[model samples]
Target: MSAKFLQILLIAMAATFSGCRNNSGDAHEGESHEGHNHEAEAKSEAKADPHAGHNHGEAPKFQYTAYSNSHELFAEADAFIAGKKAAILSHFSILPGFKAVEEGKITAILTVNGQESRAELSAPTRKGIYLFEITPSTAGKGSLRFVISEKGGNTESGTGEKGELRKRGNYEVIVSEVTVFADDHAPYHALQPEPSAVNTTVFTKEQSWKIDFATALPAQEPFGEIIKTSALVTSSQEGEAIVSAKSAGIVIFSAGVVTEGMSVSAGQTIASISGGMADNNPAIRFEEARNNFEKASADFERAKLLSADNIISQKEFTDTKNRYDNAKSVYDNLRGNFSRSGQSVKSPLGGFIRQLFVSNGAYVEAGTPLMVVSQSRKLTLTASLPQRYLPVLATVREASIKANSQSPALSLGELKGRVLSYGKAANSDNFLIPFTMQIENNGSFIPGSFVEVYLKGLSGTNVITVPVKALMEEQGLFYVWVQITPELFEKREVKVGRNDGRSAEILSGLQATERVVTAGAVQIKLAQATGTLDAHSGHVH
Candidate 1:
């Protein structure tokens, strides 16, 4: 073979070998790409199927329930995982016979271990349902806290299980916890939109314990128009007596110690009066009169014997007899009252010594006004009312007296009294009509003490009422604290009608069977001003 032919053959063989090697490499790369595609497809399938290779084991299902102190409010939670977000479906309802809550404000929070995530709450729809969505940072052993605030047209605090919520002026907090699993591809059902919004104060059980709060239910009772006015307690004319000096003399207290307010009985000797050394002194007059009486009596007796025996003339015997009779009458009249020492001054009636006019060793003239004794068992209440109330004066069925602003009012029914009289016309000075009521004093009333009078007209139907202490006033507007729950209270505006200082009638903004804060209302007002108020924690069940 030629040399050139041999070189061409070698080149051809080398080229062929290189081409085969390249083809083999291409085949291997094609197999590797196909394997990678298959692996990716398998992974995508596993992720799409929720029950593929994942094992939940015996993990407890998520479940939660909530209720308010008001039997009318109820809530339930259904939790599940949806992709990377955790969704909670909340349903609320009112009892079968109660009025439905029109709308509510809702807030939700999710906590996993120590990590917390705020939830996006959807407004409630016509079905009264809400949905909460949260993208949990990490999934495993977590809880969801839900808060729902709702109000009715006539809703007030202390009316239901939402007590603490009412006090803090917050919505009812219904807390529920459920163990959940979190995963990016977890399967969860979708929920419809339900929109709502609310802001409320939360007064927790712990907070209530700190404040030492209490509550009471409102009641339906007989109520009437109350006419308020000022009054004066005075003594009745028949219940008073005046002691006066009977004659001119020096006064001396019978008991060494006689003071006002001392109890004395009828016929008790209060003092003694001794005549002074004057021309009209009773002691000297009695002595001189006695001497004359003795002389005249002896002369008359002798004359009488002579006349009967005809020993003296008739005219002389008659004159002597007349003188003796006259002197006898004088001695008899002064003998009982005129003693060498003094004359006794006694009380004619039994009562307390209300006043003392004469001091020890003081001189007093005859018929001079001295001291007054008052029987306080019976007293008179004089109340002045505006002329406008004159038409209802005769129809007044009840009355009460409060001695002072801080004192409790005493009712006429309890005191056993009635209206005695009323002025026919208004007074010239104040244009106020005066009315009097006689009261059997029970030792609680004091004469001359000013008081407040409440006169009630005829009773009407049963109405809601609360103690006066429950009311709070601001800028002439009246308000009250109603217990929403044991520890929760809400401030509410109220329209007040008749008030008797102890209790007031509610004409609007309050309901029967609702509870009110009879005490500590002022403290609540202060708390609202400082913004330190809180509501009870959401119920955990």
Candidate 2:
């Protein structure tokens, strides 16, 4: 073949090779496009997964606590995952009453990157627990607020108008520092660590509602120095009276029975003095006065006749008239007071008979003491303190008195009382300084009864205190039940300082913000003895 023919053949072969390369590239491109479609389908299937974030494990529970004027909200929610459904559980409690919220509407609003989403529950699943589910729209940092609509929806006029159902009140609890993670693979840490279960007691809301249960935060207040002592309850000067005999005779009780503590009214006849064989007898005096009056009348009549005949001087007639007048007056006075039963003795004031000085049918002389009456509306507390505490007595500002060991201490301020005086020198009998306080009786104080007294001094310092009832004595140490959450309480040993009957000072083992069980502590103690405390009550699940 010629050289030109060979060149043409080479070119044809090169052109064919180039066409083959192009066909191979087209086939490879088709495979690549198909692989891309497969990847796209895989991604779409992953997005449709119902349990994408939850596949690893259950989400960590996030808890938030908030308070409103009407209610307290404790909320728990499963950590958020973007484009995934999560569960939220809310516990609502009424405030000031601390009862479970039986009925209400709760709404959870979630906001992320200026986008907002909400989930609402018409009513609580349980009495106070409202459980619901929410889905986060996007993955980023977000915030949540729980809006609660109290039961008994109010109207525009706040009077429950027909067909106008506005919520009675909407209480909002904001959850801060909330995050929506892209996936569940990342480590999560809760905002607040869960409280430990050790030394904790579970007092359920149901149990608390069934009985008298109450809680109060430790009060930061000025606490005064305390001086503890015993006191005697006695009737005040204005609250007591002495009943005396108006005449000398035998004592006779009225129809109504007279005894100690028997109530009497002012001007009510309680007893009578009858004539006896004694010299001061009313019957004897009456007879004497009658005889003397007869003699005086006889003399006065004879003198009057003589004076009419001008047989007597003017002075002698005047003397005779005066004697007759005196005799008549004496006779009339004896007759007025001397009855068949003799003289009646009436109570000078309204009160109860405190002491009977004489017995019925007993002989008594004139102006003799019979009985003692007490109004009992007011009382005086007299206490004796050691001479060493004289400085404290001078600084006393107020006092608290307890009638008995089982009774609670009564504050002088609350009883409308005041310190009357403090003794300047020690008494000879007890070698102690005397102190007196006047208090309104309130029917609890009994005269002559011994009581516990706590004199509060003026020197005070700011400290935290709780009601005296909050303390429970174990062996000798003082313990208090501190509330960790709404239902969880831990028995904490507190260092007790001065206590003024009603309140106790906490030197340690307590915080001002923490709450304590003021009432029903004994019930908890009994429950503790019975092992009724649930150890796992702190777990949200």
Candidate 3:
């Protein structure tokens, strides 16, 4: 790659790795290993040789090259094996032109053990060259021949010596790069937090609004509309009355049918009997029962009077009264149902009858829905709240609402509401708590109309604050990396409070003085995972 292109690629890499390199876990010092010298030694060795051939006989069987500095080429055997994985450190561009050469092109050659194997030097680019490996390939004095040509440069001969037994010199390729703390302006450390203030962030019950945030978080964003849950609502009466059959025969509503949805009203045709109801004697039986009840009633009243006058025993009076009540109750029930089947039917309350289960012609055994009537209609609004907000509202209390139909745009111009609410217990996998509110429809809201509910009397002032993006929650624990210096950052665990689904309240572990990572925490996080990012060096994160 061209130097400029490589530099460009590095910038992009720094940005990508910035997130991962540091955010994973480790703290970095940006320290690198020391460099070694090879250039001077090479030139000095060349000077000593003075163009005169080294006595093939005198050049040590094991000799070295430092690039001429410290002549670092080490050797042990006759030949060494190395793969095409070669690092070429040249003074000029040799990569592009060399790569242009034919594949497996021979750029270098080697002579070893009376058998010579050509080591090809290849340039993958004009600025670089890779030798199809030779040295270190075999275990001994690795050997090779140099036949490389450079762009705008002359083809040259590589200097190697013929050795006897101590299998000598191996050529060393040298590369150099400065290893120091990169400048804050070195195209990487821009926007790092300054280091003059305390290396901490602070906030309290006041000045929260002024706390420096890493970014903006808004609440106007749209959320999914809440779906409604269906329910049945009813009111109980002041009295409990029993409606039953007159005899042992089947008990059915005067109307033959029964079911939840079927509609019925007073005086409506319901059900009738086949045998007893078909004859006039069912009425006869009811009259007989009524006559017996009248006699019992009169006898019981007389017994009560005699007991009061001490003319009868208390036990006798009590027995007479019990018998009279039972007889009268039986008589009344028969009288009320005699004209119909032994079945006893009653009128249902009234309203816009919603459902009708039994049809006009379907037969029902007994206690079936002949029909039904509703007394009134009502409206309800249902919605979900984040679990954190569940505790702020009360059960069965008024709440303010804005409905499109009734108050177009809801102009109450006055604060009003009580909280009657129910919702899920906490923020589990499903973070929403479901709730419903009963609203008396004033010919305004419909059952399915959309509405917005506003919780009233909810108020708060200043509190600890932080940017939403800076907070990272893992395993329910929250943390943020605070930029502790122009070149360092410290990962800090924090306590979070009141997340209005936007900025969060920092209850602890963070403050206003330290700046936290806002936009690239993920990059820093991934880098930390792969051990590439230095958490200690303040940069992108």
lDDT of 2 by residue, 160-243 (tens): 112233346776767765788787755254335679877778776557656677687898887777998999999999989998
TM-score of each: 0.49, 0.66, 0.29
Evaluated against the true structure, the overall lDDT of model 1 is: 0.68
Which 10-residue window in model 1 sums to the lowest lDDT? 191-200
Which candidate model has the greater TM-score, 1 or 3? Answer: 1
Q: On residues 472-504, what C-alpha lDDT tens digit does candidate 3 reach at each position? A: 889999988675431234567999765432245
Most accurate candidate by TM-score: 2
Candidate 3 lDDT (Cα, 0 to 1) = 0.43
Distance from true location, Cα of 215 in model 3, Å: 38
Model 2 segments beyond 4 Å from truth? 1-56, 66-191, 277-340, 525-541
At residue 523, what lDDT does model 3 achieve?
Answer: 48
